[model samples]
Every structure is written in structure tokens, then in C-alpha cells.
Target: MDFDLTPPTEEMEKFRQEVRTWLEENIAEEMKESLDADEFTEEKYWYWREKHKELARKGWLNPTYPKEYGGGGLTGAHEAVIVQEMRRARACPNLSNRRPPETIMVWGTEEQKQKFLAPLLTAQMTCWQKLTEPSSGSDLASYQSTAVRDGDDWVLNGSNVFISGRGPGPAGGPDYLFGPMLTDPQAPRHRNLGYFAIPVRGPGVEIRSMNLIVGRDSHFVFLNDVRVPGDHLIGGDHQGWQVLSTQLEQEHGGDGGGGQALAPDQSVENLITYARQTKINGRSLGSDPLVEQSTEEAYIDSHIDKLFSKRAYWIHESGSQLAHEGGLSHLSDKVCGIRNANRVRDVMGPYGLLGIKDHLAPHGGTQEIQLRRAIALSHLAGSLNIAKVVLARRMGISRTQERAAPMRTSGAKAAH
Candidate 1:
């Protein structure tokens, strides 16, 4: 389908065609086969990783971001065309490229940008975020992890949990997992945070793969007294919070609107495909009235979320700084996670009630994993309660009002 794209410059279009041709020609046959088998071995994954860098080296992945920083420096319209083509091809975007550097480039110093953005854009090194402590979850500001300054180094001590895809997704690929951290202790709780572009592998950094309820192993990373140079500090020392908020704003939706990055949509599509194919009794699962209703609800929720998110993205792309509603982006992200959990749970049902593999009873497999994953979603993404809190706060309803009105119970109660 031809999308109403922002027309690319003639040169950009020429570059696009060249890229499409190159991907068709050079993306390895073995990697394609591995992706088909859902076998993301390090070797097969590296094939795709190399391809991402090749594109990056050519300035095709994030064109219009900035030429100096290894972005193509194209307009948003041009980016739309790139995204549309990648989607149409059923090929992944350069997932390894997007968020962290974009966050850094926007808020990092010229030195910070020079240090991280160029290498990131050129695919020289990979970075992962270190936020969300064991204690902090979605109340990220309350993080117990501290980056106290020690001479020219910042001694880091904390653990970040439920970080995603340290290896790859269903299809083999490199992980793009980078984040902001708390840097300045002297600043206020919200204001003292700082962002860092840390690699997945570092001397003091350790990532342990977690087998999720679903089939994948995301990671849990522990940073123990890791020493990062002061120059690696993004957006200055105490200004960490300033940089951190900008990154969170981007993560919640886009810079301005409520759009998320890639994974959420892919997850929804996966569930929808399952609904279309999986059957109960004689009828296709997609045909059953209840299934259809769930399907419609899922679709509606996904589209509404996407629309709001895209709107948010454009607002940010246009240099706007405010969410239309104060915490709408966070609320939208919360909705996306909950909807994903609910949609998958409704379709999968009692089987999903079974928890993780290690705890699986005699009759266990998909259901156990699904159920556990569904439960974990509430915690892994923003907690269900956090979403309500954001939504309540944004709507200008006091906590007392919320308690009195008695909104739906959160995942905490549902888990029981």
C-alpha cells in the first residue's frame, strides 16, 4: 500500500532505492533461514548486525537526524518513507540504531554527542540503559542506585531489571538497549538524575538473561562500582535529571506525541496473527464472536495508541516540549502494555494461567509461560498502578478522589 509519505528528496529517494536493492542482494540467505526457524544464534544475529552497520555507515538508517552525528540529516517526511518501505518489506528497521543516541544527541554535550552519537550512528559500539532498580520499578525517581562522583570517575552501584532483548527478538538481530541514570545526588530527586551511554558489556557490567513467560530471554544487568569517565556524563553532572526527563519523554511516546518505539506494535501484531490462525472447536479462532470482540478491541486499542503516539512523535519532531495532556504519554504507554497483556491473556486463557517454566506443573508449556508473561507485563513495563497514578494526576484528580471513586483494581490485586 502506498502511504502518504513526506516526499523524500530526489537524492534521498535514490539512496532509498539503492538500499532496497542492496538489502535484497546482500542480506544473507542463511540469516533469512535462521530468522524463519526462530533461531537467533550469535553468528546469525551478527549477520543482521553487520547489515545494520552497513546501512548506518551509508547514512540510510536514520537519515535527517544529523550528518555530523552519523544521521542522514533528512526531514521527518523522508524518515516516514524509510519507515514505510521497511514495514512494507516485512524487514526490521535498524532497531539497533534508534533511541539512545537520539536521546543523547538532543541533550548531550557536543563532546558527549561526539563521543557517543558518531560511534552509535556508525554502529561501532552498542549501548544499553541502566535504569529501573529492583526497588524503583516505575517510580524511577525513587531509584536507590547512585552515581556518586569519585574524582574524575562516577562510581556506579545498582541493578537494572527487566531490560529487553539483550540478544535478539524472534528474528535474529542486535539489541538496542540503552538508558539514562541518576548522576547528581545534590540536585532534587527528579532533577539529580543523569543519562549515560553504557555498553552491554563493560568491566563491571554483567547481564543475566531472564527466561520470560513468553519464549524469549531478556536481561537483568548489574552495574557494580562501574567507573565511567566524567566526559561520558551526558548533559552535564546535576543536569542529569534534565537529560533524563528528555529521554523518558521520548520513551513514553515521542518527543511531543504519544508514539512508542518498535516493540509494542510488533507484539500486538504477533498476538493478532495468533488469533487469526489458532482455532477452537470447528471455527477459526478469529471467527468466534468472543474472539472477534477481543480482536476488535485489541485492534482498536492498538490503533488508538499508535495514533496518539504518532501524533506525539510529530509534536516532538516539530520541537514542541509539552504533552497535550501532562502525563498522556506515560498513560498511553501504560495502556499499551496493559492492553497487550490483556489481549494475549484473553486469547490464551486458562493455559496462560500456568506460570514460568521452572515452576511449571505436570501439564505445562505455552499456557504456563503465557500466564506468567502476562502477569510480568504489569511489572516489566510500567506497573499498572503507575499508569493509573499518571492518568489520575494528569486528569487533575487527586489521590483522595481516586481512592473515593474506586477505579479498577491494579495488576497487584489481579495477580492474586
Candidate 2:
């Protein structure tokens, strides 16, 4: 087993140069400056959206996706180069809500794919994953949101909290919202649900922003008797658990082989810079052996996290059976994030806690935001304990061996 990454071929190298040149010439300075902003503003949101549309037009947004669906229809290596160059330019567009489109590609009918997936893949619209409800966060099977069958539509009624999406103002909300809804009250746990795609601007769909310690653009979504066309229901009625498993697998880091290297965590890099620049007793703080050692540890931990993700990505691209790999990547990211946060605080003390509002905040207050994220990440995708349990189950270290969830790939692979 060679642990080294295969070097890019000549064709790949040429493609990389092409991507780098395109990004350098096209990415606006405003967009580059926005990357350092403390929070994503309404102006910044639209700026990024325009950039997303630009990439979509070039078919680079979903490069590995089939060309017929408005993707570049490129290979995984090509996609990796696009991702790498985009990150190198610090102009990567936000395409985080990928679960819906990927799920649709797997279980949807032809009409559904054309209707839902094309817009999503092409960046014609945005989407939000309404998974966590007011009553259930981790235990998704216990979701109380109900979708009752109507003549030719499904009437959804429930509230979801901490829902994430792009855009800021009411006019800037996502074009679609998707998640599991209880369909059969009398049925078994996994069989009682239906997955749906609800239009955010449609009647009875309401969104209210939630204020948090950190400035994350999260919201509370209220669906009151929201009517969704029957065709919008995916994977057939009562088979939502199966469709959801695909999305959850990706979300939990099971689908790490998305043909791109994980982007380096900016916060870690900024922390290192802070340690090297800040003065202590007329010498750089990083010059102190203790502070230097701690900073290096943080860097090492972040690198390890990226490696776990890379391995998972490689396994998926190789078409090998991917069990426990995604879990390992997800678990490593969460744990390493916590560890790095502690290291930052230990070295920088109170300065690490300063927000963007503070005049003295370092790196545009990203360190402060990272510390908050470290606290919130444990509960966001899945808790650290939940990640551990899932990894154990996937690795067959439990009472009963649990198989990894099935994932269906579309022409253009969804980004994690």
C-alpha cells in the first residue's frame, strides 16, 4: 500500500494551469476581499452568488457532473484541479447544500431530475437541508414534521430549527428546502417517513433568522400546511429513510471521495501567524519554545484531519468498499477542531476570544469565530459521541455489524 498521492498526469497539469489562469483573470478583487470579512453580509452574499453563477455557466461549478445536466462533464482529476485552483485563488463559491441534488440523482424519476437537479447543479437556485427539527436534532427518525397525502400533493406542517443555507435577507433565501417528513404515524420507525422538496417562496413556508453566539446565517423554518406537488416526493412514499441514508452518509463524511482535497482550515493558519507575530517580552510570542511547540501541534492536528479526509476521498474514487472511512474523517475533523481551538486559546489567551467588532481582533476575528464554531460543530452535523458510535458501527465493532449506507452518484459528483 502506497500512501503517496499519485502525481498529476501531463493532461492534468495542463488542466491545472488552465484553471489557475482562469481563476486569476476572472475572480474579482472584491470577492477576494470579502473572504476576510468578519461576517457574510447581504452584499457579500450576492457577490458570491454572482460568482457561483459564473462558475455554473462555465460548467465548472459541478465539473464532474454530466454535461447534459449543465456540468463541465469532466473527470475526477479535472474536478480536483478546479477545486485546488479555486481554493488557491481564495475564490471558491459556496455549494454546501449538495444532499438534495445528489439524493434526487439516485432515487428520483427522470422528470424530477430535470426539474430539481438541473437548477441546483447549475446554480440557478439555492437549497437548504431542513433536517433538524425543534424536537429532534440527532434522532432524525423521531422527527415530528408531518407530510399528509392530499389529492395530488403532500401537505407539510412542522418547524425545523437551526436550518442552514446561503443568502441573508428574505428576498435572498434559498429557492428550495428539502428533508424527511413523517408520512405514516402507525408505521415502523424507518418506514414512516417521506422525503420532500418544498419551495421556500411557496405558501405557508416561513423562515425566521436565529441569533447565535457566532454570526452563522442559520434560521428557523416553519412549514404550515405547505403543499408540495406529489412529484416532489422522492424515492417513493415511506422509503424516505433509505433516501435519507444517502444524504446522511455524505454529511457524516462517508462520501469523502468527492475528487477534491479538503480545503485547508483558514483559522489554523491564522493562529500560527498570530503566534509568530504577537510580541511577548519584546520577542515574538512564537519565539518562546512552549508557544512554538503548541502552535506546531495545532498545525499537525489540522494536517492529520486533512489526511483522513483525503484517504476517504481516495477510497471512494477507487470504487473500493468505503466502510468506516468517512466516519474516521468526520470524527477526526470534529476532534481535531476542538483540540486546535484549545491550543489557540492556550497560546493567545484572551486575544483568541476577541470578535471582529473588537479593534484588536486578529485575522478579522476569524479566530473568535473558529472558537465558537468548535463549540457548535459538535452538535451541528453530528455530536462527537454520535460520530464515534457511527464509526464503531460502520467498522463492525458493535454487537451487530452495521453496513455503510448506500450512495448513488450522479454525472457530476456532489461536493461535500
Candidate 3:
């Protein structure tokens, strides 16, 4: 409920100005144009690589991570400024910038951090989470991947589906998986899970791109007796579940998901601009009462989404861990995703239905892609239903109490 501004430090304000200057000079027009391009051609890949390397060299890619490990070590406020600048420039984040190495940092050994964190954070390499197998979607505890101990090494064998990976942002194909393999069949349900740093290109590893409803591919990686050194195993032989939580934190937590997605201000600005220019029935959409009303509604929805997200971000930053309530962050995420979809469908209408590749439709800047991104984000990121379960447990309410309370009508009497 508190609305007082969390003032940025003088250092952060200066950093913002520096980032703005660099973005003005470095963000290429070609990269911006490719936002509407269909194919992830080779040239597009180069642009993505160049941008990532540019940011890496400038120490801007890993903002808010440890500075010693190739991160910017910037505060949350500075990160917000950087995200705002990127959205304003209409330059999408380099694909590497969105990878899942931070999870490794939290759960991996000091040696693991030294080996993978720097390259992953610096955008020198890309990583993906390979937890979701073909047979297991949400029930990860039941995964059948087996890693057997042999001398100082472990042999991994299993297949993971729906790995969200790309080589680079604009140019990269969805061709990779990132995470460790703990494929020990003999170990207990949770204990057998072992994390391995399997490279996507090794002899026993194979990745195939499976396109989704939204057009982007989710990699299906099959691991066949891949040999991994003892050092490559994350946090030892049976600590996979512990490390898994850390990775999940990155996916569900604030920074990774919060600032990167479509911002309210940016969405509102684009919607308003399209409304002003789009025409229907010989009248400018901006001037039409219905169109104007829809536009305002979209703005309001976006505003609510952003406001709740900002509140959650600040809450996390203010040294409080899950202080607001359990599942508050997840609730905000669902709201934001639904609100974004509504805004896109209502504001863009026929144009919104068209994919990013369609050049003939007006406002062809990946808005449709952005909408589907929200939906996928809502579903895959975490189950909203699971979130409610967590919240119910946190609030000390039994499942029956919570479910029954919602169904009670005014005329219904409670039984003792």
C-alpha cells in the first residue's frame, strides 16, 4: 500500500545516464528492424552476438550480479533504469542475458561457480534448464533420468522436453539446454536426482527443435550415456533437489521475470500510437468512442499489472523475504500475463491476431509474439494453482477450509 518513492542513490542515477549514452550510440537499427523479421537467419544471429558482446565488454550484461564474477553488481534501481532504457529503445534483451546461470551460482559449489558462472553471465555462452522431461511436466520428482556412478565420473541418460533455449537473441536458433543431470536410478526419489553440466554438443547429447503454438521452438534433448567428470556434477551426487530449488528461484523470482517482460508504460505508449494511426469505418480509431474506451481500459490493466509488479520488486529489495504473503509474486505474474494478453487482443484487434512475421498487417513489431510469450510465461513459469496451495499452507488454512470458504453463499449456514 505504501506509494512513497524508493529514491535511487546518486551513484545509480549516474549509472543510468551512462547506460543511456551507451545505448544511444550502440543499439543498431538493423537489430531493431529484425524485431518483425520472420526467419532467424545467420545475419540476424550475428547482430545478436554483436550486441551481447558489446554489452559484455561494457560490463552491462550481468547487471545486479557479483562484480568479481563478470556481473555489474548494480542495485535493483539501476537494473530498473536499464530495463526501461532497453524497452524505450525497443531493443530486445540479448538471449544470453536471460539464461539460468544465476541458479547455478546459488546452488553450485565454489568450483562450479568459477567454471560456469563467468562465461554464462558474460554472454560468452548460453545455458538452458533441462528439468522438464517428456514424461514429467510438473511432477519433476518422478523423472526417470539415470546417472550411475562409475569411478570418479557419472554416465547420464535421459530426455528432457520443452527446454527454452536459443543460440543468441535475434539470430540464434532454439538449439540448446542448460542445467545439470543427476541420473542415478538407484538413489531415492528425491536423492537420486543429480545435476550435471552437460554440454549441448557432446557425443551422447542430441537436441531437436520442436516448434510450439507460438512459433518458437522448445528443444527436446536426448542424453545417451554421456560421460561427466566428478567436477562437472553440481553440489555432489544426490543434492539435485536442493540445487533445483535455486534454479526455480531464478525462473520464478523477481529480477529475471519482472523487468524484462513488456512494461506497462511501454505497452501503453505503443497501444496509443497505434490507436492514433489506425483507422476503421472511415474514422480514426483514436477519435472513435469505443476505440478510445478500449484503449483506456488496456492502459488501466497494464498499469495495474506494472504497479503490482513494482510493489513486489520493492518488497523483495526492502530486505523482506516472502514478507507480503506466500504466492504474492506468483499472483502478480498471473495478473500481468493475463492483463498483457487482454491489452494486446483488445488494442490491436485484427492486427494483434497476426504473427510477428506478417508484414502486411499494421504495427508488425512482434506484438503477437509478446502476447503468446505472456501466456507461455503464465503456464510454464509456475502453476497458479500450485501458488494458491502454497498460500493456503502459509496462511494456516486447510485445503477444505479455503476451498469451502470461497463457495459459501450469503444464505448458506456454516455447519459446526
Candidate 4:
């Protein structure tokens, strides 16, 4: 594998300085404190909104998007500088969160772009992927959240589980849902889906929080008779499934699951610290060859994950279409993250399950917290099996695209 990374040009450096300056000023102290404390209270949610708006207004949030709709209209290289700066500041969200707006720009109507995509540029709204169902385990086609046509409106009914929407970040950006638009209960399996946005705060929309390990939480949203206008639909009627497939492929190809990138990656560092503090026969735990080996493996996997993600980001950001890179990166990230967590647990043994208040818990019990999160990550965003399927299809070893195409087209034809 090529280990070389492209160096930023002088222009990028100037942009970097400009970005750093803006972040230094606009990133609030309280928001920073919240991140340090890993707190996501309602107050912190409001802060996420403000921060997103500022970043949007400054054209930093949508750096690679067309400037006409609140983006900076930049290239991959430009976004890299912005990302580098944001990573250094420990502000912003995962690269995945940054993708929905781009998808809106691509598949949404011009008006939709203006109303919804524009805010993404300016951080005026926060969007979550409300795709998972109580019964569907990492299967988008199996989504049972039905949106039936009612006069000029679409009345939605059903519940989505495992939505990873934190309280609007530290900004007051109201939450929205990017999920399946097709809801015909009798439709064929893969065809009964299209993607669209639904205002999560609308009437009949009830979101109950589900706590993860530590202070983190996911959401369970119930869309009970929540009505959305036909205008909110993305792509042609029943064209949603196809559009959604394209979006996922593009997301994997381009961003490698890059969302808002709000949090820093401190899992490996915390594990290392824990190992150093631990004692086996009064010697540093890290001194033990087995422990050292485990830590080294984690360090390597984490490094590979970052590099793989960067490569995928570079491919997508450079205006290239990714066939396998996105899936590869995503698969690697999940594998590496889960693997690293297990390794840490092995290193810590019983103490890895300790709570933050426990004296035996190292790094405020981050290892234990990570174990919980790691387990969730297995199936949360996308399961390993799902990633592998995507990768295999992208690599032409699987005929899912062919199977899916026929199903998607049949659904569209049925709608007509």
C-alpha cells in the first residue's frame, strides 16, 4: 500500500490559517467544556446549533458544496484543510453528518435544496438517518416505517430505532430525519422505499432517548400520524429507493461515513494510558509482552482506520466516484474500532467494566464505556455483514446491484 499522503499547497495553508482563526474565536468555551465532560444536555444541544450556524455562515461546514446553496464550493483539497483544522480544534462532527446536505443537493428538487440543503450549509438544521426499524436489523429494505399518501400530504406511521442523533449538537439546529420516503406496505421488499426528509419535531413525532454507555445516547423516534408535504419528497415518486441506494454508495465512496466529526478519537490514547498505569506483578502492564502486543495491534488498526478513511475521503472529495473505497474504509473502521475495544478489555479484564466513579476504572472508565459503544457500533451505523455485502457488491463479486435495480424499478413502475 502507498503510504504517501499528498502535501497541501500554499493556498491550502492560507485557507487553513483563516479556518483556524475563525474556529479559535467562534468555538465557545462552554461547548468545549461539554465535549470534555462528554455532556449532551439540552443546553449543550442548543450550543451545537449555534456552533453549526456559525460554521455554516462562515462556509466552513459545507466547504466542498456549491456556494449557491450556502456551501463554500470547494474541492477535496480545500475540504481537507478545513477537516485538518477542525480535527486539531476538537470541534465539528463526524464526516457522515456532512453528507446528507450533499445528497440533498444531488437528488432533491431545487426548492428542497434551497430550504433544506441551504441550512445544512449554514448549520441551521440537524439531520439524522432515521432508517432502522424495531424489526429491521441493519436492513434498509426491511424498513417498515410507512409514509402513506393522504391528499396532498404524506402521513407517516411507524417507529425507528437506533437513530444516532445527539441533542442537536451544541447548536440549536432543530433535528430532522433523512429516511425512506416510500411506505407502501404491500410493495415488494426492496422497492418499498425512497429517501426523504421529515421534520423530527413535527406533531405526532415523539423522540425518546436511549442511553448508551457513559453519557452518550441514541434515539427511538415514533412517527405517529406525522404528516409531511409531498414537496419534501426527494427524487421522483418511488425513485427514492434507487436514489437512496445511490446516496449510500456515494456516502460510502466519498465521505467514508464522515458526519459532522464533532468528537475526537481518544479511545486508543485512553487505552494506552490505562496500560501504562496497570501493573502485572508490580511492573507496568505495558511492560508485559502480551499487553504491549495488544496495544501495538490497536495502535496499528486505529492508524489504518484513519488512513483508510482519509484515502476514501480523498477519492470522493476529489470528485471521483468510489466503487469500493468507501465500503472498505467503513468496514475497516468498524472492524478496527471493535477490535481495539476488545483488545482494551482483554488488557483490563474485569476492571474494563467499571463505571466512571469506580477507583479501579482507568481514564474515568473510558475502556468500559468504549466496550459498550464498540458493541453498539457493530450493528448501529451499519453492521459488519452489511459493510461486507456492500464491499462485495462494489467489487463485482455480488449481483445485488442487479437484483436491487429490478426491484427499485418495479416499485417506481407500481407507483405510476
Winner by lDDT? 2
Against the true structure, whose TM-score is highest? 2
For each candidate, the alpha-carbon lDDT, in order, equals: 0.57, 0.78, 0.62, 0.67
Best-to-worst lDDT order: 2, 4, 3, 1
Tens-place lDDT per residue, model 3, 246-311, is: 555444543325455324355466778888987789877889787788787776666655565666
Off by over 4 Å in 2: 1-10, 33-38, 170-172, 257-261, 410-416
Separate clash counts for every candidate: 20, 5, 10, 29
Superpose all Cα atoms of candidate 2 onto the true structure and report the RMSD in Å to 1 decimal. 3.5
- Per-candidate TM-scores read 0.72, 0.90, 0.81, 0.83
Better of 3 and 4 by TM-score: 4
Q: How much is 266 displaced in model 1, in angstroms?
A: 6.5
Model 1 has an lDDT value of 0.57
List the candidate numbers ranked by TM-score, top first. Answer: 2, 4, 3, 1
TM-score of 1: 0.72
Better of 1 and 2 by TM-score: 2
Candidate 3: regions farther than 4 A off: 1-14, 97-99, 168-176, 180-183, 254-258, 261-265, 276-293, 317-319, 323-326, 356-360, 390-416
* RMSD values, in order shown: 8.9, 3.5, 8.1, 4.8
